[model samples]
Target: MKPAGSLALLALLLAGCSAGSGLTTGALLGDDKPAAPVNDAPARAFQVGTASARAVKCGFNFDPAKLKTNYLAYEKQQPSGQDTAKIERIYDVSFNGVAKAVAGEGEYCSETKTKTIKADLGRHLAGDYTPRVVPKEQEEGLFSGMGSGGSAPEYKAKHPMDNSD
Candidate 1:
């Protein structure tokens, strides 16, 4: 075989080996250094897991084995560079909420819940996180208007006492 063809065969062999034998082409060809970390929104780390977790949670609530163990547990074991622990509490609380909603019952597993689940799951997967704004304690009343143009029309109201003029 030609040299280039031989090299191509070798890479394919290494890729296949990596899948089952844990022998990767990068390690084999001296490119074994770890990849650089990707900095992203904290929510990005959960983008994939949380999507699946929603579906799995339903099955997990009624039958834990059906969805294959817990989301945080299984996902953490994977080689994701992002920290899954940071979002553990979110998954925990959400899962507990699911369980509590159908405690001692199978309503969560019913067809009736499918529409709600689909709508929520669709929104969950459609990725745009807007944090709620909470006013600080020190900040007094009369908040700034939302969006760019903060030009709220000013109006002068005449008080009864002011009409003494």
Candidate 2:
């Protein structure tokens, strides 16, 4: 059997290493949890500035006139107030992601469909730009599909079955 004295010394050494304090004094004291690592995405005061503009255009098929009018309505109706550009960017990002996921489906979106996509997209962006609840109900028809009915858009016409000749 090994000496009991060696086992006690080994335990002390292990405890000191695990405690993570290089100083001898610290080994007698408890250790603190490591700091949470920083995320790479910068937290901007006006967050989503980069993504907002593109999102609005891509998600909503509104022209300057229409987009302005819809924004005005959002300002009037939404209690949280509007940061028109910021909200737009968030929607634009959401739309692009969803469109890409659906394989460029935004190209054929309708007014209602665009709004629906905006709502779904808004939810995702809300977490991204916290303390700012971007309105989900900006009524500009941004994309090109009707909310309910339409065939998936095709890039070119397919050959008819009759071509089997």
Candidate 3:
């Protein structure tokens, strides 16, 4: 009984040590969330850019002309007392990130990728982005044919009777 209890205590201590052994203070505390971006002007701008980049990576389409228009709209909607330079800096960083992400996707011609990404980022910044949602009918249809001849191509093609030879 004593040996069993000692082994259990040792196991618990080892587990605790392993769990607390992360190099960062946050990791030691078991907190995995990223620290909030700094409040300084440049840092805030970078955060805004990072957020915009992430949005593009998540599938928002690019449209530059619309983005410019949206930026103008956003600028006009800002309170009259806010600092213009700070706002511009944030916008600049955001647009740069957006461009980088869009161009990285390789979905468009090289010449037009930058333009498309810029537009897409602009659309996102203007609050125009929305994730594509499958309609209920379509979702139902997808599962309706499951396990039947009309299911996925791979499964249907692999069915024994599907071979012409």
Candidate 4:
């Protein structure tokens, strides 16, 4: 092949390689938005837990295990020579709110409840909110066995008549 034809083929291959890597030529050229990380595990877990707690406070039965969380890195930047990444974790609470509505057993969460969930999530992500443990009385089955006293154990040596009986 001629030199021009060879150079064109090489360019095409490079373009194909870059595109396959999820970074388009436009992104590489600074014309398109860069891709962000999605559904980060830690962030999602925190969000779901926060939402469930807030829902419980609002008198709704929401299960954290049933909550669905989605995370998106709204902004990410690496300083010119720095090795660390500056990433902003953005939570999609709306989807989880909808999921709560579908999976929840009680009344639908009010708008204020959703806002409180989001606000609490923001505070949690910002390291400002500390989670409060539910009181033992509020937890399920805390008093189910209240009247059952401990039974005394019978020792075989002390009760020698067992075999004859």
Candidate 5:
């Protein structure tokens, strides 16, 4: 459970890495879907930052201050001589309710997993870091044997003589 490996990691990413305001607000407001390494850097950065913040806020003992500063990304309009309005993401940072330190409850991760997540998140927060592309094989390993090729192992074990194809 390295948070950086295996099936669970894929799930975390597929969940839209839902944590930051920049995750969807700008695109939703501007009617433009920003692609990675192109225009979504801010949104991507915010998502990772928010996750670190959440881990710290949730008491996973993640980092420096154990706090998360929420940020909002908004699309602003400016007067221009061009036909189309200029679109950009404006950021707003917040630091309220940080002293409360709400302790996380239930299913705490081991220190190893916590550290792994912290490191992974940190790498993602960097400016020039592109995400590590997980190979298709690794991603499919967990579910590769599910409902395919034959019946469940238990079913075959129960019907010992029923080997007819």
Candidate 6:
């Protein structure tokens, strides 16, 4: 009778051969430069765990479509970058409107809310991707004054304000 260890080795060889039949035994002996990438987005760095922390840096560019709306009222208020203070004031008002909407006050309604997020989003995008205006002292101080350690506000609406601004 065949020895137990020899039988197990034979079974393992059969399994490897059957599983990898598509790979020619000869190709393993060749010296080839690696295969070229398939398309624009790379595949090597995109494993499951690593992908969560990785982002496709704005590698591709896009054009502004006609559908895109101009939400920054501050742009109309001051097109030229000459007046940072006035632009910042308009931004503050728009941000306050956003905060009120987020607070469930709905001071800025559906249409106004859309305009508000857009405006703030624009200012944030334009100012080196940072918020152009800091919120007022009252808004800044609201968090420390809150009863809790400022967990999520007690309530939320379809649109919430960045009360911290």
Full candidate order by TM-score, most accurate first: 3, 5, 1, 4, 2, 6
Question: lDDT by residue for model 3 over 50-71, one digit each (tens)?
Answer: 4355445545565444554555
Q: Which candidate is the best by TM-score?
A: 3
TM-score (all chains, Cα) for each model: 0.26, 0.22, 0.29, 0.23, 0.29, 0.20
- Once model 2 is optimally superposed onto the true structure by TM-score, how far is the C-alpha of residue 148 displaced, in angstroms? 30
lDDT (Cα atoms) of all candidates against the true structure: 0.37, 0.35, 0.42, 0.36, 0.32, 0.29
> Candidate 1 overall Cα lDDT vs. reference?
0.37
Tens digit per residue, CA lDDT, model 1, 37-144: 222323332332333444554553333332223444444555655456544533343344333334555444455345434444554434322111111221222332
Put down candidate 2 lDDT per residue, 65-133, tens digits, no spaces.
344344334444555554645445333333333333344444535555455445533633444332222
Give the per-residue lDDT of model 6 (tens digit) for 15-42. Answer: 4323234344443664233322221111
State each candidate's clash count: 0, 13, 5, 0, 0, 2
Query: Model 6 off-target regions past 4 Å?
Result: 1-81, 105-165
- Which residues of candidate 3, in runs, are more than 4 Å off? 1-28, 33-62, 75-80, 97-165
lDDT tens string, model 4, 78-149?
A: 123221121111122322333433354354456744665655555444533233232223222323334455
- Spell out the clash pairs found in candidate 6: 102-160, 102-161
lDDT of 5: 0.32
- Candidate 5: clashing pairs of residues: none
lDDT of 5 by residue, 47-162 (tens): 34434443555365444332222111221121322212111111111111111212333433456446545654566434222332332222333244467766643221111011
- Tell me the lDDT of candidate 3: 0.42
Which run of 10 residues does model 1 get worst, by summed lDDT? 156-165
